[model samples]
Target: MILILGGTTEGRIAASIVDEGEKTFYYSTKGNEQEIALKHGVRLAGALDKKELIRFCREKEIRLIIDAAHPFAKELHDTVYYAADELNTPVIRYERIYPKLDTDVDGIFQHLDYDGVMSSLREDKVRRLLTLTGVKSIAKLKPYWKEKGVQCYCRILDRDSSRELALKEEFPEENLVYDTPDESLDELLKRLRPEAVLIKESGISGGFLEKTAIIRQNKIPIYLVNRPQLKPSARTVDGEYGLRATIDEFLPQFFPLHTGISTGTCATAAARFAYAKILSPSPYVFIDKERIPVILPGGETIPVQIHSFSGSFSLRRIEATVSVRKNGGSDPDVTHGMLISATVSIEWDHTKEMRLLKEGELPEIIFHAGEGVGTVTLPGLGLEVGGPAINATPRKMIRENFEAVIERACVPIYSTPIHVTISVEGGKEIAARTFNPRLGIEGGISIIGTSGIVRPFSSEAFVNAIRKEMEVAQATGAPRIVINSGAKSERMVRNQYPDLPPQAFVHYGNFIGETIQIASELGIERVTLGVMIGKAVKLAEGHLDTHSKQVTMNREFLATLAHEAGCSDETVSAITQLTLARELWTLLTPSELTAFTSLLISRCAQHCQPLLPNGELTVLLISEEGVIYG
Candidate 1:
């Protein structure tokens, strides 16, 4: 659970961001203000003191705190820090972006603290002063003004509390200016005609710029009070996106939402459990005697369950097997609920064991493709031709897990040779639905996982894959790279560039922006983007993410492109009436098709040039019939 101390724009955005899966509570100090509507799982509550706040966090099981309150709310900020310290919880401060002061202007005084404001006022000996700071600090300034006999005017919110604060401070009714922040202070400034303006350094959202500009235009001296200095230990972010990123770091677990452990993670857990069982008495090495933690590639540790385990040991041989059910969550994957198993067998090898012991090294751990597991038969994949279809990430995971088990148990690995076989139940049938058949991974699905954890429908994972593939291509000393939308386009591109190595072709999967940006960053000399008409139209309109859910094909946009291509009104109308982008081919004549294709390719190139600033880009539009729009 998370708690957000919010009253400003940043607070509202933070609430929305953390409110998705976590139970978030938004705290506000103002009671009379209108309540802002929030999404599900976010509850709005009134303010609490330090002790009360600590009690609330404990009662609610809050583990993270996001402080997005006003910068001037020193009391509230202090309370949040104290409560977080007492609860031993993490706190992220969403600080506002302060506007740059115009130091070039004459007769402007800026102070880092409130004392500087008082010093400047005392030095100036100003008789009439106008304060744009809120009513909360009026009491502090009243003493100084009264001692100096300076007639002070203050602009505050038009609320009963604000008026009462001024009245109790003995500020005259005529000198009290009651208005909201957005309301212009022109009337009050003109009526008072003060020699200077006193204000706090509220950020842009707090009308700091507007107040400064108005005071400067009136030729009034400005005294700006800097915000209080916060603790250096507090993590501070300046924007809504930064706040979201901070919150994600604090609470890294994916919950009731659509997320899953990768197949590689499942295989690693099974292999590790099986290997651990061979060394330990129990089948699992429980963390704190509760659960087993499988560390993913990204350094995130997730608890996995061992569904079943069995082992047998003899005089010269040891055998163990473990199974873990794959959980794909909401990802549209074929192997969602399948069981993945790993069997480990070790035999005494005297000759090899003697050589290994002489060198003080462990014996080799061999891997095998068991039943329902595929074998690589292609040259493009980063594996031996006859090796198991487990990719490099999963292979590394398995080796790491095995080594971890050996190190934890101090097993005598130098005396034995081990072989581990990884298998998936019903994976061969599932491979037919994936790209394994076309990729030449015969018989079964590949044991593939890059991050070891699947964020359902994760665009980040797709974009990351494109980046990794581009990096691999760049590492191959390939001067040119081919970027495609999917496997079909990649195959078509391969036919076009037959001589180029397979590493030179990458499937972007609706991540055109990321692909181009990565290509430019990798300093590739040339890039060819092969896309279908549906995605091409979206790209032409500057929608880099061409996913249907992210951006729909704009019929009017297509019609406009057609009109620009010198099509007739009737033809344009027919194109607009068409439902799918591919339907336009049937509606257009040969000349119109040429014109439309030319315009689309031109538009795509125009939009892609900025992303490929240092590289050359070529756009290829493929039709429904596999015809290239050259």
Candidate 2:
């Protein structure tokens, strides 16, 4: 949630920006000003003290505070800073843009503070003064003006409260000039015919420029009190766009969140940094080579950070290790916070033991799976029977980044043999939560990433994985392909098809239509789709993309189907009112279950027919009790 401290024009603009979303509160001191309108969730609160402000933030669960108050509101600024510090909340200041003053002008003098303005007035010996500063400081200036024998005329807001305050301060009623929105400052100045004009340097919205122009036109000297210098407690922005950008960066978890670099990209960056450190004498080496911007398969070129590095040099060998922490952005990835490290070692030998490469070829780059790195024991996966679990894309990334750094360092490409071992901390424990064990990847998690970037809830990544799996399965000369919604459904289907190879099982995630279409394009003779009850219902309704955000189960459609299957009105109503699709199985009788499953299978097969025109498509609905229908 956001809290906006507002009153000025910039504050109103900030309020408008936050109004686009819920969970925001707009605040102001003056109740007489125009009230801001917002959506249902946004609240508008009046003035608050330091203690009340902190309590308000705590009660509202405010994550961010925007200080967009008037620049001259020094006490309010201090209070906001104190309250925000107590709450440990991030604050952004929307500062007003002050106009640049021309000190070179004939009779314009700028004073740093109120004292300076008074000192300047004393030296000038002005007979009459017209002050545009607000009524709050009228008492402070009354002494100096009275001592100088200057008749002062003060302009303040035309409000009963303002007049009462001025009168209470002992300021003469005859000299007090009440200002309305429609009043002209030039006419007032002409009527008073003061010797000099004194005004505070409020920003453009405060009419500082207009007052100065009128003073100059009347050939009267103007003394301006410069704005107060208050140190901000948080980051500050001047304009509306800057405020929006800052808000986006601060609270990206809310909406329009940005994607982050993948673990594969982190490993690649670590490999490059490690290789560069071995070649350079300094503690750190910065590579400045341009090679296609190191794009991830997802087509995003994100920046990477080298978290830590260490190196050592021994007889005829140089070794360096670097670590990079993976950032999953807003995605709930298992490896989001894992530290992926790479150790690069270069060995040189003048004897016959050294391996030589052909001309124009690089050194022999060998990859090793260190601790926390998995090894492939399965035949279906696109890896050697016994090799490192690093997938093809990450391997390519590591090789390319290492080669690029070596080339820039001007190292001998053909002489030294480079060995890179990639590892992840606590990877084995992390792998337990994934499908690595089921896929026959033993020891630890696989260093697998097709795109070096991981987008939050990315459908493209899942679709791409399905396509890769299909290609691998087709490469194995498999006549039939198995597609499942998730790991659970895949396991159930695998048990049913014990003879099918591991490569033949593809996890389509939510892209059922895409999987069938890709399988048909790959020339597979048969396709089997394994679905759980939750997704089976959506598929039966012809939803190819079964993500809840894309499509929802239509209870009316289910009722119609149940009625056509010869269920009574009461049974049909129960089916329609059911919250979960799985609940229907418990409510339905044996005959109803048979009729419903048959109808659902026929509808699903009809939808799959267009995607797999050349191949035969089959649907298998499975649950914990085993295959419900096939």
Candidate 3:
């Protein structure tokens, strides 16, 4: 068994990765301990305080403990070291990986503490200081303002919570700059040339290396404050490196192993249940709840919704109450069993929406509930309730994809769920680019996934979600919209329309029918579909099932196209699905390939007309011959 001393983002992320079948416990701080563990469905072994941790180790038979707590979580890190020694257990320090120095400038220095950092700077020469040390330590340097006579600035998370902290700490509002690594620091420095820059080693998040490099390029000195040293006996690793490396090594067991409860499997099951049955009907209910009224294909039942039937029937529903429980918690005093009763109403009817719903086996929902026991439950037939609120995964995926496209996308992400909550910014432009507006999911993007598993090479789910984006864009009065297949295409699309609202773009993988249907539904005026060759061809041929799992290269179709283009039959049949277009180009010279692309684009325009009868459709064939027939 492993107990992770978690608190920081890296710690939560690491804990989130903890798999079942392996004995692992996440020890959080007093208040957040239960919440963090529950969020990831990892066992919470109470705090990392000596007594609770030691007691938990002995009781749970914890063989190894991971100190993946915050870098500045000094006391907990120390306690784990001492407890491990006392219990004679292996203690691994899962450290955060910090970015290396990527700057070409000179005169930038790194130090161990604030005083050392302050002493090294050019006291009289420094005109402005950019502090990237977050908001916690802003007060420490305020006293120096009178003596140094240098204007100090700090970059922090652009959150209202962070803002509240800044106001409480009396941080200078003018100097309270927001942190964005991609933002042009050169422009910033040019506007306000500082003599020195003060910063903390905030690992990768602080953008330490990039910030330093930017400051150094302007001939400014950087006052790098080193992390504080823990106790000699504290279990330590190479900060972020150790944490990430350990998770990478141990995470596979949770997914593939059969022993112990598997969080991934459980979450996968839950997600499948939600998607297959719950998402369309009772999308409101969660894991650990009882007596959920969920509508299915036929009649409704107060019990459960069943997708598959073992009897001689097409599909069936049962009216039954469901209960959830947990096992193998750190607490030795209480026996584990069902923790909550969730009643679900399952019914069946032949609604077109029900028949057209996405179908696949669901993923399991796993989490640690009250105490340290892990819980895995599938709500395919019913509603699930209990466990900590986990809405960060969807947020992360959304932010990552959005930031990748916008280059400077800065939206505040809440670790918790905010249903019906309003996000003024996320609601404005970016939401139009997403499906949130259509789904009636207000505020920022929804934290999603039942099992927390992303299928390999599958874009069906993502594409299906774009219909919602179209609805949102239409509702927001976006006349001209750009739809791309993935992140790279979205980035390129954004570059093409720099002034367009971020919401005016959508990432629709291969669900050509769904996206176009949304366009038709919304009565869109114009649509620019950016596609890779394979998907465009699928769309050109009117294949609704564009999923890689469902469709493959039609050798006959390719051969026909090849023959029509005067290419050898062997050329079309021999090529892999992914490289078919490029391989088709190989049969012809450069000019012919360009002509073929144009032909494909022209065919695409013809094919899309049926999908968008009254609306204008522009097919942008993105390949070696950039923007072929837009």
Candidate 4:
């Protein structure tokens, strides 16, 4: 279905994103030197020209191609592009993150290609040179060194194949240095005492900045070769999230479940753009404007859209409003496709909005709840009663993003105060479908996302919701919490815990392991796990996460369980042939039910009890007919 051209870091990143899916793709490299680990990708080594690539695409029926090879691999890039174009297939370029070049800096020389670099070196007549480029460039740089007999030490990989390539180019063997010496690059330059250092614009991951720092320390001029030009119409994406989203657009069924961004990230991106636009020259933005990249908690930046912007200027303050619609990620929660907006107001002299700020308060940024955003009504959720229900991580993200803008805008921290109001359109109606009412959050959805991204079923959002529920349950002083897979099991187990409050019942989806672990970490003394037949079968087999992706139903294991329970050969064989785990109830007789249920509960407890050493654990197996097993 797809082909990925890889051998560099970008290629590895592309492979990781594709591994999240179920379909098998091809990952090709020029040689077998790069070691990679892939789950569903077939590895093909050696190069392919234009005609061969076209034939390969035809044979494999590749509908999409991802070009993630090295930037200097111009021939491969052209071949793949032409082949994909002839086949009428789309291409997604996994581009590397490049730092802006500063030609004004001393000891740095920029050139368009290797010929320019060699011509400049010849003009300067440098005697000693240290090259950090790879072994493949031996022939390209030979003219500059061989013609004048310059002393050049080219650093390359420590493989025999690399040395043979240099020898084939008639380059001296003693002039080649192998990879990974004990000394630092700075120390290497000192030891070699070369007149110049050579490097390519290899971006941040290639250690380009560190190599330049060594050159600056030695005060040696460095020749930097720019990256080769790529096709103008290539579709490029820089973040991992972008790759997944694009793949889904091409192949809808590539991933069983898709991923999405959180409301907090959406709110943050909206506020970041609004604050920047309010201060910049532009005041109006259309829905078709460019996407703005937001920095994630993990330090990776993902581009998000900011639209419906309107800015106005007044005597005391200037304000702008922008909204970001959540993408169609795997998790289609209430907030998905909802508009998370931020209205940012900057008080020029702190005169009009002075009363809103506390006396002597230094933080230039303040947050407020708008129409649809909720307000805290209780103490345990970590916010003052009557305050906005935005969580700590989103608040931190807003402040950090604002600080970057202020630093760039040359605005003093104490000069003006910026107020941001975050709201979700139609949030009040959405809150009814959520657990916000039980958690003492009223009016709308609470801005929440710990990782700023959401995976589909059995994601961090599900686990986070469970943790918050337990916190509220413990705050209510409930002696035990009842955790269930979903509404059906929770309703079946409710009558057993009649005295427990409503907050005591929490749903964990497929996150049985996370639910109990959170209760244990919070020092909750008792936990009750109510699981349906499908998840219970997987949990009994020591699979904590009962998601089908992690573990599926094993008929052979169930046959063993039935045989151990003293079932007849007919019943054992029937279990192995049953389509669903719930069908076991009809197949089992009343005589062997108790022993089978007991063995299943015993096995589930073995893997779950150690997590809650200080607490009492109860595993309840609920049947399709509302039968209570253990």
Candidate 5:
């Protein structure tokens, strides 16, 4: 058994690349590790201390350990190293990929240490400091900025805590401390022009490329921070080559009986196989109508229809002008119907078998594992089911049309039938983001029409979805509803309640009161509210509606707390308004953080109790202390 300590994306990807047959374990400090692990069919272990780590490994009978923990998680890394040394198990620390600065930017400066950064900033004019750095480093800059009296603006993550931090710091309410870049940098520059920009070399997905574009457009001096270098003792790999080489080298060691097992070659061979099947001469027509038969590889059959197709090749640009007629006539005037021209696209992976779903006119490729297979539909070709439901009908027919013709068949017809991917010319790029992340639904949005017709509003559908999800959660035998605004809390909640399935936890997303009410209505016997500090204060103040628009900084209440604690109004307001419960604790010395966390937890408990008077309520507040209440 392989125990893989994974916190970073690289670790996840590395784990994903491991042999399909190997039993792999992926561990995370935060709670969502289980869902992720389950999705990929990997064994998951929650955040564990040094002793717990040893016990877990020994009990699980783990043979090898892979420490793919975040570069910054030194304690966890040390624990893994120590655990391996004691258990006498070999450990491989998968090195994380860091952002490599482009050679074009000349005046950009890079720093390793925070103190060094402070000193370096002090040397320059440093006016209008745009800390593209994370919120974790904000406190360090606060003391310096307070003394220096320099105008500083930090671009933190556009999260609730970051927003609250900005509000607490009194960093110009109108000029946001952090923002998501939907608009171009040129537009953003016009909004908040800065002389200098400080940014971390966060990898590709971290929006470093966009940051560079913004910086270059504005021609602002940049203070770039480099990632911590790996220790010399650790084995390392370059981008794709390292990952490929490691798997190749390790595969033979483990599977000596298996020959010709190259990861790259396998992927290529698989791609070829999928392509060959798609290009092969086969029956591609559907005969569903009686008496009058219509062949539709393109369009011109059904009136007002939805065609769903799935294949290896891209069909994003394969637009078909569809014309539909009633029964047996092609008279446009007699048909009295609608015409739709739409792009046909397919989502198929080379690694999986053909599993097509035929629901009326729509044909979808049912994904088994990571692969998609050819599944085509002609929306205009009215099938045996007659005219599809008005809402069930697609506006157009979309079928994958491969741009390239393959002459050579690499694999034999019976050689385990390796699947190959269809190279849909423009299909892949068009579906880049939608196909990869978010919405557990992978590949792309299913070409589905439930109502048969597109309606003006979809709010009722959303409510129905939530209701169904709630019912599903309740069915899982989770008595206590765990509603969290953060992903981490839900994970921790699951760890605490191993019997309770993950779906039971609802991500309320700033709808604390609404979630509570829903749980109460749904007959949830109890509820555990998990929240960070930013939302805690409002909850304490009986501002049940914690929406920022509904909440005003209760200056008087904060002033009173400050006076009771013997602090200034500014100090108290700042402390009270802090989104981070940990930071609020910092205002009070070492002894004070707990007191502060406790006070806030009490406030939250008091505010929450009456909302769900019938249910047993437990508000678990997580601050720097970690889980102050239960």
Candidate 6:
């Protein structure tokens, strides 16, 4: 249903994001040399002309095309662009993150093309040169190095194929140097000491900064080839998360399951826009017609709709109130459609505070818990007791957002404190339906979300999805189908079964009972169930559905295991006091842990093996730190 043109790192990342679901997709590359891991993606290696591309899209019924190939692949980019346009298929360009501006070094020069570099080389009368540009650029610089009779050393990837390419171009063997960490950039510069260095403006991930740092230190004249400008496609996303979100939008019905944003992101977007209004003109305050852009934790900026708020101001303090109604997408989040509000109050200070007086310091930020947000009632959740229940991640996002607003507006952060209060509409009524009440969060719901994006893996929806996967495994003739609790467990167990196909592995996401039942009905003979400590503890107690709502971790049951495993009285008591199951790794001795883990997994197997009576079941216990034992 989707085709991704990839032969680069961004292409691999895009494949991983799209592979999250059970549906099949295609990943194409110019060569088969680039090693990439994929599960649901069918790898297609070879350059596709416009005819081949359009034919493939039609044959495969590809509704979406992701151009994640190298930025310099202009011909391929053009082919895909025009093909997609002809087919009326949406294309999401996975653009790489590049420096906002060229590196400001005295010796560094920018060239629009290789011809300028050759012209500059002739002007400088340079005979010796060093190029950090890739092997493909060697052909482009033939006139400068070969025709001009200049001795140029080219650095390329340390691989047999690269050396073969250089040889095929008739480049001197002595002129080819492989890029290796064993040879430091500084050491390379010292040995060569060429008159100039040539590099591509390859951004941070390309090791451009590392290369330039040494070149700058050596004071060598360097020419950086500007990256080819890409025409604006239908849509573009820099990060994998953003790519996934865009894919969901373009192919709204491609995957049966759709992803959603976190409540933390919703709150951060609301708070971010509320503070931006403080710096905006009077007319911008009441007009909430435009969607406000908020940068997510993953470094992707997304626009969120903000409601009109009552803006007020005072001489010493200016305050703005804004709300973002949470969109839960395909997830059945209790806070869906709830109004998450942020009230930002800015004050001017006559007396400079310590933060303002410090070097490289901004204004102090203070957070408040308003009407529907919860307060921390206990420790161990990593929040100060009696403080606002906003998580550390949300707090960081809020501060970053506020600072971006201040810097963008070019306004000084005054010495006074800027207070931000977050409130969720009807959050208290919803808290009872969530784990907040049991987690000792009082008053209302807590601002949460570790990744700022939630995978829609709810019970009924996930079960239906897994049934399709089980049928696929049966049809594919897989030796054994792996059923992990979720992504975390699946990742940890991947090394154990490196040869297993991605389709052979499935994410059960708290549906242990249902997944095994489907496997039994589908005649899946061998099943490997991977579970983390948290779910292992609950599954050991015979809970078919190990959902947080269906089961709270029973410390009493864990204490019994610790006691039976010959744990000391103190250890047994400590198990009862544990806030999370993973804490058992720290609370018990190594020997005691091994015994307890065995007892736990055995109990889990006892309950699970019956579900797959006609099949063999292997239970894997993944530790908190991702160590797998059983």
**TM-scores for all predictions:** 0.46, 0.42, 0.42, 0.65, 0.37, 0.77
- Candidate 5 per-residue lDDT, tens place, 1-630, comes to 666677565565555444332334444544452234322235554668889889988998877666666665666777877787788766666654444454454557878866777778888857567777766566656665665567776666667766776667755555455455575556766667877877776656456777777787688888776766644543444232344334444444432111111111222222222333344454133223211111112211111111222233344221111112211111111112211112222344456675442222223321112222112222221222222211112222111211111213222222122222222223223333332222122232222321121211113332333444455567557667777764445545556666655556765545566667777788888888887666776777777655544664464665465556455555666655442333454565554444555666777788777778788888887653355454
TM-score of model 6 vs. true structure: 0.77
Write model 1 residue lDDT over 138-186, tens digit each, in one string.
Answer: 8878666777478888888888878988889887878888775555687
Q: Of the candidates shown, which would achieve the greatest lDDT relative to the real structure? A: 6
Residue 14 lDDT in candidate 4: 81
Worst 10 residues of 3 by lDDT: 294-303
State in Å the error of residue 370, model 6.
1.7
Q: All models: lDDT?
A: 0.75, 0.74, 0.49, 0.81, 0.48, 0.81
Whole-model lDDT, model 4: 0.81
Off by over 4 Å in 5: 22-24, 29-47, 96-105, 161-176, 179-186, 238-241, 244-630
TM-score of candidate 5 on Cα atoms, chains taken together: 0.37
- Going through the candidates in order, what is the number of backbone clashes in each? 0, 0, 60, 1, 20, 0
Please give the lDDT score for candidate 2: 0.74
Residue-level lDDT for 81 in candidate 4: 88
Task: Please list all clashing residue pairs in model 4, or write none if there are none.
Answer: 258-330
**Cα RMSD (angstroms) for every candidate in the order listed:** 19.2, 22.4, 23.0, 16.6, 23.4, 5.5
After superposing candidate 6 on the true structure, give the runs of residues whose Cα lies further than 4 Å from its correct spot: 1-3, 12-28, 31-63, 82-89, 97-132, 147-151, 155-170, 177-226, 279-303, 307-310, 313-315, 353-363, 400-411, 464-507, 512-532, 582-630
Q: On residues 119-205, what C-alpha lDDT tens digit does candidate 2 reach at each position? A: 888887877998888888787787776664679889988878788988888888899997875668888877999989888878776
Q: Considering lDDT, which of the candidate structures 2 and 5 is the better prediction for this target?
A: 2
> Which ten residues in a row are the worst by lDDT in model 4?
353-362
Q: Positional deviation of 412 in candidate 4, in angstroms?
A: 14
- In model 6, which range of ten residues has the least summed lDDT? 352-361
